[model samples]
Target: MSARLEAINITCRDHAASGARWAEILGLEPEGDITSANDFITYRIPGTEVYFAFQPPDNGEVGDTFVPRIHLDAVASGNTREQELENLLTRGMKLVVDARTADGAGWFTVEDVDGTQICVGRSDEERAAAKAAREGSS
Candidate 1:
């Protein structure tokens, strides 16, 4: 057997709001709650089978309270690098890091509804190349 990155799950305070943000940023659509308990939600990548799941914060802390931390790195589509970061900022996302260099690096760190950290950043060329590959495959 082999282990693989199936999905990245984070805990959120508001399911609907977080899900909506993810949908807009990642250009994804949610089908339904990931589980019957209605605590987890999934957003599917357009041209891939991978998924990102957001759940509720963990309870039953015995000692130090754990702050939820997770991130879903999605391809930036049809948007400038700065535009992507700014869009999320307008939607209540706080910046963690910002850089636009020729080397195609840097990332923005933002917290979810539950204070969990997520880094969103990638170059336009990278995204466009991925889009082209996806289009070619499809």
Candidate 2:
């Protein structure tokens, strides 16, 4: 049997805030009503079947040392990678990693308001070119 991934569930202290942050970051809107603070909120990334759902933590206690096991990686669309990084920073996301190659193909990791790490990079073509250069050098 094969398992098909459909949605990603995120637990946060404030589901509404987290959902809003994700929506703004992805340029998506919440799927349903987000008025209720106790209710979970979901957002579907454009051009993707996957959904991201945010809910309050079950334990009701915010863990100061909790680190997410998985981080999300995204490719910049409709803008240059530098612009995308600037946009994210302007939105109060903390820059964790900033790396670039000679060809200017690189990625940056930013921590969102909810402390979720998201890595944004250039498009596929730039990635392919960087990979080819690396392989050729090797």
Candidate 3:
């Protein structure tokens, strides 16, 4: 079958703005140049990598700013989503949404520096608790 995301792509009206914000917020360096108009500024989370493309925006308005709506989520891997959440929030990220499953597992939604929606999840503490519960049940 066809697989999961190789890289999630986001297009921003101002690549420089988004790239800079993400860099500061995520505490991750951009994988490459953040200057080229046609280039994608990248960020790698533990498991997934997100790339944001800087391009001219269509004439839409986000409360008077013509920014794009290319929202992307930087999901945490390796069971450290709680820590990841703390790290991101400490860097000025704002919680926008919180998602959960029928099994009570999922991610929290946060808005990035550019006002793009980002979904973050539980950290090591929650993961460990879940894992232990699973083991005890088994």
Candidate 4:
């Protein structure tokens, strides 16, 4: 049997703050009480079965050596890529990398408040459609 993806658990020094920041950035409402330090806060990406959960460190401390290697890739929704990038910046994400293709499709890598790198971009289909629309309008 094939295993299905469930949830991505993130260890945070301050789960509440990280949860709040992520909720605002993703335009998602948190599922659990962010104020409760004993429980994890979860955000389910819209139109998907996947979930992102933020929880405090198990040892009650996030050491200086702790560095996250995994980065999340998210598609832009409900807004243009530029608008989404602007929103991310306004919500306190630091810009890391911004790249684009000749067709005007692009992606941005931003570091969240908790220092997790998240790449936000458009899909190949979306890029093709956008390019077609632009050509038609010209």
Each candidate's lDDT (Cα)?
Answer: 0.62, 0.72, 0.60, 0.70
lDDT score, candidate 1, position 79 = 64
The candidate that achieves the highest TM-score relative to the unseen native structure: 4
What is the C-alpha lDDT profile of model 1 across 1-138, one tens digit per residue? Answer: 111233577666655567778879989867665345366788876777667787766663324565555765543445655666777677787776555456565655666566655555555576566578779999
* Tens-digit lDDT track of model 3 for 1-138: 111232455666665677678768767556666566454566554444444444445553334566455655454655466666676688788977767666648976667777866665554456678899999999
Error of 2 at 104 (Å): 52
Could you tell which candidate, 1 or 4, scores higher by TM-score? 4
Candidate 1 lDDT at 91 equals: 73
Candidate 2's C-alpha lDDT?
Answer: 0.72
Candidate 3 contains a number of clashing pairs equal to 6
- Which residue pairs does candidate 1 place in steric collision? none
Of candidates 3 and 2, the better by TM-score = 2
Candidate 3: where is the Cα deviation over 4 Å?
A: 1-68, 101-104, 121-138
Model 3 lDDT, residue 25, Cα: 79
Write the residue-wise lDDT of candidate 2 on 1-138 in tens digits.
111234566777777888898889888657777777575787887788667878776666678854333356677666667777788888899998887676777777889877777777786556677799899999
Q: Clashing residue pairs, candidate 4? A: none
Model 4 / residue 23 / CA error / Å: 26
Which candidate do you rate higher for lDDT, 3 or 4? Answer: 4
Best-to-worst lDDT order: 2, 4, 1, 3
Local error of candidate 2 at 124, Å? 31
* RMSD vs true structure, all candidates: 11.3, 11.6, 10.6, 12.3
